[model samples]
Target chain A: MTTPRNALVPGGAADQGPASTTPSGDSRRLIYGHPSLLAERPTHYCPGCGHGIIHRLIAELLDELHLGPTTIGVASVGCSVFAYDYLGIDFVESPHGRAPAVATGVRRTRPDAFVFTYQGDGDLAAIGTAEIIHAAARGERISVVFVNNGIYGMTGGQMAPTTLLGQHTTSSPEGRDSSLAGYPIPITEMLALLPGVSYAARGSIADPSQIGKTKVMLRRAFEDQLGGGRTSIVEILSTCPVGWGMTPQESMDHVANEVVGVYPLGVLVDRRAAAAKGA
Target chain B: MTAVAERPRLMKGNEAMADAAIEAGCDAYFGYPITPQAELLERMARRMPELGRVFVQAESEVGAINMALGAAATGAKVLVSTSSPGMSLMAEAMSYMAGSELPIVLINVMRGGPGLGSIGPSQSDYFQATKGHGHGDYRVPVLAPSSISEAVALVADSFELAARYRTPVILLADGIQGQAMEPVMPTFRMPDWDTASWELTGADGREPRVVKSLHLRPEDLEVHNAHLQAKFATITEREVRWAGEQLEDAEVVVVAYGTAARVARTAIERARADGLHVGLFRPITLWPFPSKALAELAPRLRAIVVVELSAGQMVEDVRLAVERVPVFFHGRTGGMVPTPSEVVDRLRVAWALTAPTP
Candidate 1:
């Protein structure tokens, strides 16, 4: 399988022309190629689902970082449960909401291995709130990739813990009333308050520019954990077109216009910088 | 690898088990503190870090069990100990471990519970342990040790059994056994497991190994369940363990396990001295239930009396094992332990009922 045309490159994919090969016929300098760590098989993710985009980013980083041979991934329940199938890495499928705890088990036992947990809103924010919080508080040497799509796409568009206050879904048909459902939790910000978290960031993939920024955030998270930092996390606000009852373009727009407002982007915490300065 | 002690040391059963686990080369331990078995976690906390092994006092039983599952997935020998209420909290992860076929050792220092009943010794979790504590079709080999020394030996065996079968194994004890102080010989088996085929170290030189139980298709799940059932069947055939005293010529045998068996041993000895033919049959492997062994001796015994700390939980398994043999049950529940004299009284009645009418 060939890499997508819009795949990330050093100077951004938009700057390169259709000529994928390098001028001197050097393979390493080719503009775009398939990620080495990603499997060639087609994924089961829905069309225009942000999970594919996020998976590609992670695979690309794993390839660049040479972590494919030493990375152990803990895949949480939900659409991303099949992450092992697409990531081509050793994976332990954890129980719903327990990926962080599972990752801790792996990281604690195999300190040389790079451990990460990929989780969704329902898996991370709702049922797994305690696991995620404690993992961050304990400063577990693991990276967490939290994908907040505002709805349970795999379970047929149920209201998620990260769903916007006025968002309507199967479970919240009359629109989520703040009085009954309470406000959406800013889990990343709350986790950032913990001293153990070395890097906590929020990013979006609603557009190309945002995707690039989000990839940078993901790279920072991976690098922080690899550098022996405790609990690096990147929360990515993503799109779910089928679950949200909208076209792919409309869903991306909704993520950009609505989701970004509730969950703002950028690095909220970077303790590594402070630690470096203190040293 | 070998039992050797210049002088036997009196240690708490939980502590002895922890020492045995360490001697068995446990690579990691994750547990939450609970009554009765809190000493086990404390012992690990003190010893594991000293040995440069992994030890984590998890947030809760749920966290502890999942962490153990994760460690086990990495092919590390892992241990987790908790009491009944905590065991209840760990049920979900136990199910996940069973489905994933991860070989982690769990010690359930059972306490009285219908829901926070009491933190005192009770064997009420027989049904829970033997009949699948968690949902789904799976089995976790349950080892019941009656004394501190036996618990020590079984703790080592638990790891071997777990690795041999590629499944979780439970060392089921009661609060009495967990808290009792007895002289124990320092002994444990060394773990020699070859986990290269499935352990999740890295995919550098081999295909990536995935430890998961999620089979989306019903047919696929059924096949997986069938494979698990087959493994369980082999475990039953190869791993049935029980100990019997004076069973050769005894007319009546007392069937018991764990703490209840300890009391039954004294009762059987006293009854034998009183010229009544009585024997004690202790099923060490609770999940397999040692049914074949019990059934084999059923025809020779006139009657079987099942004693338990619970209100007759393991008695059901006894009844199933000895189909036609008259089985009597005596139980004490809600943390109330039956005395040796109490068990003797039940044995006397069963023996009298089965006596020949001359």
Candidate 2:
């Protein structure tokens, strides 16, 4: 069976550059290559950090879609603030909790240019609650790649708004108490209620298969912008090994087991088909 | 061919600046409604979309300023207007803009405020605008206009100054100016600002660009601050603006700005008609303070009486400008505006105090 047009096919995009032969001089076809849009440098992210996988997925999609030339990114104030450093596109680093507002400004000023914001759960659901809600309500024609790792990893794994009720974080050493800290925010489901949000989905980067599924949702969210739809967002449940006090492999397992239970992975909102039916 | 100037038309200060911002080639306008300056946001909401430009009445001042920051990063000329409390809300984004060196124009229609003080006219924000605008070692150009016509002209010119210096520029006025009506010639040519080298359009056929203020390394931050300081020094040398009336022969000078300056103007004239030599020294640009010009005139005057709608804020700057010049101050705080007659009484006391001993 043929794969989808926007699907991530190993390293098969047109912009993946040339294939390399083996050192033995055998003419073998290369099945995988680095994404040309991802910069070749050591990232500051800790080992087992899911930011690398998510970044690669976005870079691959941007390269495959040839969107690198016209994409403007708004990088948030968390560990992904340096997402701009890895992506080959124009970018602006926004103040803490202001990425959605900044992206709204960029998209409005340059409607022809594709815009996206990479933010963390703490940045989006806590301080920037107003900005995210309003941008989604306005149905800004931009995409959002929200990495919800359930903690503020950059600030030493503090309790974020999406932290699970019984999750143990640096700030919640005795495990989170819903009595005081409140419950984990189901932000994606809440945002889907806005008519401006044409697409909203939740995905996980727990394993290779899950990463592939996440990429599919991300592609739909991004492609929705090209169709001039309203704000499209894909919330990615990620792993933070160092922040979670787990080994790299254990972190992956925890994300696959515990995180997904809290943030159930599925397409929560898809208004494209509804729009088509209405039309 | 000589261009015919447009006839001056009566307009409120808030609406006049809104029209002047559009005329100044503002590509986007983002603002939140606040007392005294709500008309400015309303005008932009109506005019900008009609002109095929961007306008957003943002959810709050925090959102509005950030939107302005985003638009400014994309090389769009942006305008944001608000009164005192709203300006207070914008301080965080202002600090970021100053650090990132994004050029945008902000109009702060001053009201009495320590904490939502009152909507009446006041110059209490003189310190806030000129000194501690935000939490940073950065300075934004502050222009104070005493009347609606001057506010129009200053608002138009503020865009160019912001672009030229690559810094945020503030048009600091008050409720008196915002609510007052005067005939203004909203006719000015938009200046050319070449932002090709730094603006974030896209990475099309070029390396990706980052417009950011995060310099993680201390050495790198030092270099960035050095660049900002050098720009501020250049602005201080080149952009000091002020106006003087009857300074050639004056025994006392009333130093002030914004609405306070308007009151000082009338009081100065009244003092002169009474055969006492009193002049008005009005600072148009309050950040660069116009210290040199005031210092130059210090030797000719026996006393300098600084007046304001706030409790002697700009007077400290005046004292610093003319050292040991018998500086006196008169002010009314908490939404109370000083009348010309009250200022005249202060000027009389200042003149008597400066008289030769015994």
Candidate 3:
């Protein structure tokens, strides 16, 4: 509906234009087809890291939601440092742990525009803890793609806030001993109980089917943000193969089996009923 | 026109800066209230909404600066003002803006700091101002003005430079300069804004443009850095500005910048009255810090006295410009401004020391 006249290929199929009357026709394929927001460049995420899959799913969701060009992606520092390189939309590279604050500015200024922060565990849960908490507490109408891989990836496998108990990392070389390091942070569960967040869920890209399902959940979060609900976060149980010293498949299995046991996946807070009643 | 004369008056430097920001078409101002510059935030809060702009006190210095940087992405002339510690907190955003080349205006009403140094005047950030504090090889342009009038003029120019060069532009002034009320000509100039071709805001009908700093390949980052260096080189060519005082039959030249420069005027008179044959070279722009003008004075003078509020930071630049031609320096550290008499005393010592040197 927001398409300009000249965007269409000249003299091609009129059915292949944005003005297509049907949402389920060839014109719909033309309108909602192609990867409009995924960068043409190859991702540099280490193998088995689920960042690549999450990036693709987010782009696909944006295309489906018809919010690609208008969506401003805040790419936080960490493994997703090159996220700007992979996202074809307008991307603002955020300071470490400052993505939520930056996203708040974007959403508040451009209320009609779709704004989201793509952050890693260290960025969202550590130094950026206050930022994420305050933005969530303020009920900023922004979405966050929180990729929690259980261990810090980009910075030589340091102990992140999400580092699971008994997990061996560069910082916790003897493995995250519970008595020494304390328990893993159940971020989504903790945030979902808060009043500000409208939606909070945990999902993973352990397999292709789960990847497909995660896309649907991400779409819901984005829709919730667009529909004037409070802020939301979809925590992706990502894999860090290089840091974990395992193959990508093994890492995916690790997330599906080991990681999800600690960080359970479910909609912790659903404000749909509240939103609908208010409306 | 009858109503024009009846309009309200009595504005401070911070108030003038806010008015200039509004006139320059800045759509958003995100800042925290720090004394000597608090009125800037207050004025914005009052005026931004009436002019159909946005103003918000960000959670912290870090939050405010990042918010301004975000506003820059949508092609807004976003600005943020801060004191020393606050600017130090914003060090990361300064580097981000410099590297990403998003046009932003960062005003530093500098206070004392080697830590939470003081709430009073200091030029300790001279090193930080010229040197991009966070990370990277780019220098954010530093505009040092001596008065409120220059603060307003330089702000408009800062936005223009940020857009034209795609970098963060700093309007560096100390607390005294920020707090003092000076007569400013309320003149406004409208910059020709054609968003039809900016890299951000989707570039509309133009070729796709990228606004980022990540270059994985060595060759790519190297090329980007070289291109930026060349741009700064061009900036040096066109933007080296300063105010020169008497040099006819003079053997001593006092070098200063910003408020220190204005203070040197009185010291220069005192020194000349005492028959020391002294003059002044006041730097208007600090990063491109009047190297050519100072270098030109090296051979003619027996010595150059670099005066500042810090422990001789600008002296290094003078030495770089003049190349060890009996360079004498006088400065005070930790939130203390060098009084005119202190500067005069330094000049006397400099002339006496260098007079007997060769």
Could you tell me how far off, in angstroms, the CA of residue A56 lies in candidate 3 after the best superposition? 2.9
Tens-digit lDDT track of model 3 for B1-358: 0112233345588888888878888878999888668988999999998887878787788888888877776677788898888888999888877777778888999888788778888888999999767888888789998888778778788888878877788999888887888767766454544333543443223333445667778999999889989989988888888887887877888888888887898999988888889888888889888889888878888888888889878788888887768888888878788899988988888887776644
Structural RMSD, model 1: 2.8
Candidate 2 local lDDT, A158-182, one digit each (tens)? 9999998888999999999999898
lDDT of each: 0.90, 0.89, 0.80
User: DockQ winner among the candidates?
Assistant: 1
User: Tens-digit lDDT track for model 2 on B1-358?
Assistant: 1122569888998998998888878899999989989999999999999999999989999999999999999999999999999998899999999999999999999999889899998899989999977797999999999888788778767988999998999999999899989887766557666678898888898778999999889999999999999999999999999999888888899898888988898998888888889999999999999999999999988999999999889988988888778998999998898999999999999898888787
The model with the greater TM-score, 1 or 2, is 1
Which one is best on TM-score? Answer: 1
Task: For candidate 3, write residues A15-53 as lDDT tens digits.
Answer: 555666665554444443335566655577776678888
Interface RMSD of each: 0.6, 0.6, 2.6
RMSD versus native structure for model 2: 4.0
Candidate 1 lDDT by residue in tens digits, A1-279: 323333444454423656546644345344566677777668999887999999999999998999989999999999999998888789999999999999999999899999999999999999999999999889999999999998888989999889999898999999988998988989999999999899999999899999999999999999998887999999999989988989999999999998888899999999997878999
Q: What DockQ do the predictions score, one after another?
A: 0.85, 0.79, 0.38
- Candidate 3: Cα lDDT at B122: 84
* Pairs of colliding residues, candidate 2: none
Q: Can you list the residue pairs that collide in candidate 3?
A: A166-A176
